[model samples]
Target: MKKFALYSLFAMASFSSLAHAESVLSFGVDPTFPPFESKTANGNLVGFDIDLGNAICQHLKMKCVWVETAYDSIIPALDAKKFDAVLSAMSINEKRKAQVDFSDMLYNTPSVLVAKKGSNLQPTVDSLKGKTIGVAQGTTQEAYAKGEWQGKGVDVVSYQNQDFVNQDLISGRVDATLTDSATATAGFLNTPQGKDFAFSGKPLTDTHYLGEGAAIALRKGDADRVKMINSALAQMHKDGTYQMLEKKYFTFDVYNKKP
Candidate 1:
């Protein structure tokens, strides 16, 4: 999706006791990142991440304060204590682990190549020959698109976010684009411009590039918050609540595995 600029807003309180003895939790996100977290037309932030965050906050009988920031700065902002936790669609990996800790895998997703529907865009090093592909800058998807397709006919076009990429795709500005599979499905196919588009190709599943599953971003040594988020996620998965939310926006569970 779109990598929003620094929205720079204070969400709810950091870590103080809440009203009626409950605890308040803060979650930061890149609001323009769709199918995960993004602002609705009515100005409300609603998406899979929002719903999942809200559910976790509710189950804990606390409030969820959302902070919107640039995708590139989210980790640093979180480490600076701008927010207590990151509910943004951040993946867990070694690079991130050195700076901050993450909760257990909350959801899984894969990266896919999106192009005009019925186009013969195969997932091969050669298929991208002479093709211009779009990707959100600073994302793992961007790295994968460039590194994997470099030296081939693939030309990488980086956009600030998902919406603009879709716009260019509809106008035939780019031959294809690569993004999260979940986003390709919910954010693209459901939109007007994406009605004529579909993501074709096998998922890019290099762990070094895409990382493992997605998790909540937290400060290093913040074990308490991590446990709380992990517990909530485990409950959701156990009770099938995770799949329920997945179906609300997707045809199948796209988490925890590569396509």
Candidate 2:
């Protein structure tokens, strides 16, 4: 009788576990930042984030569904539960922490100022005074530029996305742009239109604006989901899955400089 009772309990527990399992996890991505998230000619989303998100879902035994969002509205959409979490290249800063919780730091990259090789525009308030600088809307670079340089006569223009900023930079629409160095290197500087552009000055770091590093953004108070995602990320690091994805996109370490 005890053996029969034990067997029944085990079956009930197994059924309970299966009932609570999440079958589909929808991720929000901006699809603007290449090497992180972007779309192909066939309209398929691909990048490091896409791969990592899929891996995380695989570990959780869930299907990964990506939802395309604008850079500016992503957080708001998450707040409204339009998607389960944000897997875009979103930096984790205090300002954002107030809006959403973040998983362990997934990666970090330096901010840089990109300009034409001969433009002689340095990334300093005094040097960029009276010059128009471009930055993606709703990004840390935008906040940094507006806070540090806008009042000093620097024209900090906000674009809808990084690709547009790169486009204007190539056409000389703006004197320069402030963006991720790795992104500029891989997505722009290496491209034909960006061949004439070069990054000037050292990497920009701001504790207040730039924050610690990029991570997965989740709705506030979703502790279960947060724990699951963090564990999956740690497992990926331990099993070399993170390294495998990193090798696909970049040569340098993007997961350092924890905040």
Per-residue C-alpha lDDT of model 2 across residues 21-124, encoded as one tens digit per residue: 75788999999888788899999999889999999987767889999999899999999999999999899889999999999999998799999897777789
Error of 1 at 118 (Å): 3.5
The TM-score values for the models, in the order shown, are 0.84, 0.91
Error of 1 at 222 (Å): 1.4
lDDT (C-alpha, whole model) for all candidates: 0.78, 0.87
TM-score of 2: 0.91
The list of candidate 2 runs beyond 4 A from truth reads: 1-19
CA RMSD of each candidate after superposition: 8.9, 5.0
Q: What does the lDDT read for residue 174 in candidate 2? A: 95
Clash pairs for candidate 2? none
Q: Assess the local accuracy of residue 56 in candidate 1 as a C-alpha lDDT between 0 and 100.
A: 84
